[model samples]
Target chain A: MTQQHKHIISMLVEDEPGVMTRISGLFARRGFNIDTITVGKTQTPKVSKIVITVKGDDRTVEQIEKQVNKLVDVFKTIEMKDDESVTRELCLVKVSLSNEKAKTDIMHYAQVYKAPIVDITPKSAIIQLVGKPQKNDAFLELMKPYGIKDISRTGTTAIQRGGNGEK
Target chain B: MKGSEAIVKTLIGSGVHTTFGFPGGAVIPLFDEFLRFEGKIKNILVRHEQGAAHAADGYARASGKPGICIATSGPGATNLVTGIMTAYMDSSPIIAFGGQVSMSLIGNDAFQEADMMGITLPITKHSFQIKKANDVVPTILKAFRISAEGRPGPVYIDLPKDCQVGEVTKEAPKKVDIPSFKPVYRGNINQIKKAADMILAAERPVVIAGGGTIIANAAKEVTVLMDTFMIPTATTIMGKGIIPEDHPLAIGQVGMHGRKAANYAVINADLVMAVGCRFSDRITGNTSSYAEKAKVIHIDIDAAEIGKNIEVDVPIVGDSKSVLSDLIVVMNEKLKKKTETEWSKRMKELNQLCRCNMDSKKEPIEPKKLLFELNRILKTDDIVVTGVGQHQMFATHFIDRMKPRTFITSGGAGTMGFGLPAAMGAKVAVPDTNVFDIDGDGSFLMNIQELATLKEENIKVIPVVFNNSYLGMVRQWLEIYYSKRYSQVKLGRHSDFVKIAEAFGLGGIRVEKPAKIQDALKESIRSKETMVLDVYVEPESNILPMLPPGGHLKEAFGGCMNAKGVFF
Candidate 1:
């Protein structure tokens, strides 16, 4: 356990009932503390893409890879480097703004981050942000002093850059 | 076909010739259907559910096939925990079934309903709860495959009452292809080549043969590695019979209470070849200091065990026999000659230093003497099962095995009552072979009721009870670790074991003197019914060559090191 760093593993799996449970159950059993995970149907009708981010050293990453590969539904698993992959996360934030000037300021910050205000009220506004995880982090940092009401985050999901490993 | 009928048919298809279990309400339907296929598959009724699990385990270990055991829901299922755990730890392939309540009444807490899968999850290699009758046969086939394939272990399946009460179409079972569970059988040639080079370079190379060797049937390959290199070999308790103990290169048991020569050789070795044996804490006490001087080449079927406990220089993950064969080929091709170093000659002498003289004819019969005499009667392939205690250690030190799978004991879990049922199961598996359960007085009583099972089943297993009047192993631990202030270790001399045997309708002999040991043993072995030989041993005598808890390899003290119970 040396050099702790976030590891992103993208997997291609057979999309079926209980397949998600098997994959997640495997990671859970290995004691691999998952930081984030996103699962959805892939372009192939029967296949699904599951991207999981975990913080661990090299050995833990290797162990997780071996264990995940052992799952029956998993067809392929590959470790994704930050530079080699395009990662994204979506966050919906509801901000509390009492006055018109506060609302204008919150909208100004949201616009700077290119986040769209999807819902609004005199007391609160819901700003939807989409980009890398860090972009959402920046938007939250900007909105903290504006009295934030609530937030829901879509965990970091990734796809390897270019046409490589698309199957 | 009814679900119960499908299960029986699937079991027959899977080559399950025997099953050990007890009948209960939840399993009544299955039992009724099971009786119809009686000659096709024999179900031995055990005294308790736990006994059934252990018997199944014992059968699996001895027969080299998956053993089956069935039990009712709730209590019956939970009872198999100890037995299933014992099998799990020892890598025995056993498929256990737990009858569940109807699928509708599962959560209603109806009569005899239990979450069998949840209880057995941690202990089993895998657990399944079948929901539909159509899935019963496929699930059964998968259970068999999972239990016997790769690194064998127990697999539990919960059969709901509803699934067993239905009529469904009979169809061919699907192929078992859990791709993720693929076991690596062939060794990586590059790694094998690297390991061969490491072995060739070392002056003092010691091969530690573990249970994996037996599990993979790799003794012939292990011997090839040992004999070709003249490398001194040591065996874990579980690996006792990898080769005949009398073989020149064999260094007997290694670890706490293991052979002194073996402990010395390992500590002094330049290179260690750990084959199929996990360097368990008991095998490698104070892991840091153990084999610290050696460059280790660890070979095993399990990838997780490679560097889990001890760091290895070269880790080869594959079946032991396959790896050993690949290693032997690589070594034979690369090496010009068998490198006979002076270290080889020293190993032979060191091996002799570990040998103990058990000729003492003291008042109370010595367990060592009993083991020595017993060894004489036990032929090459005779099976010996022992309950966990000082008797187990003594058996490890003295019981000689010329063949594999002949020595059975609860190695991983060290469950006390494993001996009787295990030996019973082993005898049942190989009916013609003489199976003996060498147990301590304290350990024997743990499952003494199994005597009735043996008597009624007509299973011939000689139970040699080492009546020391105390939990001998715990007492020894007290002596070494607690300044001999023995607490809760003694079992006072009140019970008569032979009389108990007679009550069970089995004959028994009580031997108090050393000369009568042979007479008692022969008489018990020749008895028409299941017999017990209560051989009284000196209570104070402790098993020697014990490495203290967290002690270094060469730091072992007690008997075997010197003639008069000398401590080093």
Candidate 2:
């Protein structure tokens, strides 16, 4: 039986044309299905930090990391696991509340989950939550009985919990 | 002018209305400008940059328009690679734009500083990196032109963050000039005459069409020639729908899983006209022995493709549509009827012989029956996409494509998830067209995440999975050659595909009974959302009429009836 585990990978690459095509081609051809990926600029100019979250076995992760590093633009690749890293995901949940009583009940539930009411209307309210995927999932599950209308989630973004600068 | 504004104008001028992308810091300026263009352009914000790339590919295949995708620097840019390669392999026109680091820090290993150009050189048709803001417009225009013209494929343009923020004169180049970018459009007249004479004089002549016909839009011209000459035609998997399958001259696909008559005819032909096809190993079993008795006349847009695999007696490098048109005209002028009624009768007899062998009652399920049922239930205009491997060959062999643009599958790259996403793209392109993805269980799971996208888009496609619980084609190879060690071939745990479909908020049905396939397919087609028909086929069942790899095409195995009348 193949064991499934999640890994967080961070890559530093040269900003150039068709870089994405090369990276994604490697994954697709190699048959590695990526779960989530987040990209943003770093503090240094011309450099960007890419956070990729993938669910696969240890061998698959190792192969992906090695192959990704072989790309011309890639400078480095670091894999972060749950125990070794800090991760967070943002979620916006729009819930339907027919009356004042339901809105009050929903707000009460949100407060217990540490979610903030970002926006409120007569018929519904949008609650903002930020935490690990599991935490967000649990909160969403708890609020499911309250008639959830829609949910938009930003896939996991992570950084090393304690900076050791191993690289 | 901001780099984003220039990019938008270039796309609009190039006739692009839709784009898929995910924005990041380096690309914020472009996305901001995108908002200002609002109604002029439509952007689909995908969950991931990779998804955006695939979505653009989907859009392009369906619309026959160049699909555009954008991504920020580093990871965002890297994510688009797979989709670009997918487009490249399938000859789908696409333009991908990525954010890059500023020119000053380009080689300094600055944040997100990765050499995208070098990485994508082998895969992309063309790639450009903008050093100056003024170059963006011309670069984009060139990329578009290169992507859409002749043997369409993916092109890329990288814009530095500083360039996006810089000012430039609003002058867009009216034309692009490239010295080495000429594509041949007309066939050589002498070669055309020689091929025509051979076809008219030969006792048996067969035409093998490939994806190049679709790329050249030469289906009509090909049909005209076939009908005029009363010649039989066969297609590669990518060549499906190039010739209407119901046409009397059509012989279905030719390959390992090709029809018995098509394979037999190819071996027996006196002259073979191969048009716009690369003659992949799958099509030509053994390069040296393929069409050993026949004189081959090969016409293709890419000169490199000719004589690369199989040597040709007559080679013409030009566009398929134009070459075929010239051939038709020449044939009409120079040719007289050379009737091969005897040869036709013999071929028909062999076809009948092959048909009888497939009717064995000992097998638990007949693949041909499944295909027949699917063909019966599917609409004439509905699109069918398949994953690569045995199932793909089976679908090509059995399914009759009656219309153009009704079959979408990966022929070059042979990517697995291609079926589901390509079908989605086809459905999105023609909302009214019923699209179905015929896949195997091993292939279906590759990009099953698209189920979420399908659900979100409310796009319905019927996914008929040939669930034999093994990598059917590879297992066939191992069984035939490697003594069937069965290393990682069997899917040990039965996948609850129906349950998985339900989890994705789509309808699902498990077909254990073969009789209910037609009804299940009909219902799935009529449904409002995506549906998965998990079919439980026999694990050890192999596609018959197998041509051993690296062996002569004529020396095909299986599809033979023993003395007891049992098909082996």
Candidate 3:
């Protein structure tokens, strides 16, 4: 049987207009679904680091790498194994407070998860959390009772573990 | 200097002399620039954007350059989707331009606005949206380079009205600086040696030449290898004219509707050397058993296609000519002469045994006889373009295309209405050569209005419509797959192509019997002005040696009987 597993891929791409569209379009056209994605400025101003998590069989993953490399703006691509990578996701949620008891409960959950309450009001409270994707999901699920107004989650960004693991 | 001027200058810089386009509001400034440098670059004004796209594709395929086309926003840009996809599927290098809505009105649903860059992203090798006038020259140079570089395909540039009209003080750039794109051209010496070793050892070997052989201009290299090793070959639809089909060792096409000898040669072979060919499902029926007996040697420029479909024993990722040239050099020293003498003799015997009888004397005219005469009447260099159907398969089967870029067809997309316009485009590219569109009755009606373009432009192209009164290919499927219940396949004798051609102020003729087929073809050829011969043929005759659905090439069917000795 073929092995289907989640792969963490990173790329240094040209920070130009339509670069995102070109990269995303390649995956979409080939039917590779992106589980999570994050884009950020790299050490070099003109290059951006794009981290993408996707699920595919071994052959499909290999083809995905080749297809992604075919794009002109993409400089280099590195595949990071799930066990040998540093991964994190950040989420911010604005929840409505019905009473003082609700604020106390929200703070208790935040402390347990090492999340910080960024803002507070008589009718609402804003809490910020950072962890793995599953941790953020747990925080959001626990915040449901406090009447969550809105939630914003940054997709997981991954990096190779340890020194000299760069490609 | 205006941005549009920069764009035109870049076109001239890239050695482009001809382009096809239709002007609209968004591209007015670019059109003005085209007119300003009118003599330097020739732009053919087409009736529709799709025509421009297809004509440019034909010109590109004929002349070995990236074909160019321009269209306006919204409907104009959308209309080119078919042509763009056709080029994409067949791996043709075509540089297309779409005039987008201004930067301010990109997503505001402004008049004549369309997301061309987004729509064409999947179809193009690279797509760029020009935000600044200064970037026009660089973008165009990149577009030209990217389109023709590795695994050649269409590239698009979405030039907004604002960018076209914007002014740039600096001159157009001379060199492109896209650091990320580098195409691999040379094959590894070790892999070359391994392939040469296999070629030297194999007793029964057949070579499968594909479209990439033509794109890489590697016909001479392939021919050298064939002559030196005595390997018989079969081609796909797009690879028809890569090498002369009349060569003694050629077994014609392979796969569905392919020559029976070609399929037999491959299925019975011990080694299959596929050069620059993607073993698509259309070519390799039942991928699991496509080449079960052969240890495959696959050479292509695209690494993605190496083992994408059929499994390969040796996968070499490089240009076709380079790899084949390297193989030839190594084989000369590593191998003995006349290695495939017995295999080659058997190939010839099988070819003669399975050759379809094309000399039928039946009434209402058989397709094989007509295609054979058409093949005999045309010049070796005269180009043949085709739309999709049984006629397409017949043309590929019978016509002996002796020159590269002489047989143009929509092989990948199987698009109808590609024949006439593509013929006109080829004629425009090479004025001295005669162009013929071997079109089917159903495929001909899709863009018959292009007859007006032919008459107005005085383009000397012959439209030989094989009027079988049905969608012959689809009807064949219905006959084989279903119980002969052909729905929507018959076109119940309503439209008169001869009268339609005359209405467009062109010459026309109708041939109903077998006796008139040759004379009708000759008459169309002799007349200088554009003409059409509405030749009616037998509706039941199907292309021979067709692979049944979900079957291997060994189990291919011919004349209602399976080549594997089974009758269905």
Q: Report, for all candidates in order, the number of backbone clashes.
A: 1, 20, 0
Error of 3 at B394 (Å): 1.3
TM-score of each: 0.93, 0.73, 0.92
Backbone collision tally, model 1: 1
Model 2 DockQ (Cα-based): 0.01
User: What would the per-residue lDDT of candidate 3 be over residues B219-264, giving only the tens digit for each residue?
Assistant: 8977877776888888888888887777777887888877777887
Of 2 and 3, the candidate ranking higher by TM-score: 3
Candidate 2 runs further than 4 Å off: A1-167, B46-51, B336-340, B352-367, B560-568
Best by TM-score: 1
Would you list the rank order by lDDT, best first?
Answer: 1, 3, 2
Residue pairs with colliding backbones in model 3 are none
User: Candidate 3: lDDT of B486?
Assistant: 96
Task: Output the worst ten-in-a-row residue range by lDDT, candidate 2 chain A.
Answer: A66-75
Better of 1 and 2 by DockQ: 1
Question: TM-score of the candidate numbered 1?
Answer: 0.93
Sliding window of 10 residues with minimal summed lDDT for model 3 chain B: B559-568
Report lDDT (Cα) of residue B467, candidate 1. Answer: 92
Q: What TM-score does the first chain of candidate 2 have? A: 0.91
Q: Per-residue CA lDDT of candidate 2, range B187-216, in tens?
A: 889988888888888888889998888878
Candidate 3 lDDT over residue span A1-167, tens digit each: 58888888888899987888888888888899998889999888798999998988977888888888888889888887777887888888999889889888988988999888899888988888888888898888998877899988888898888883443
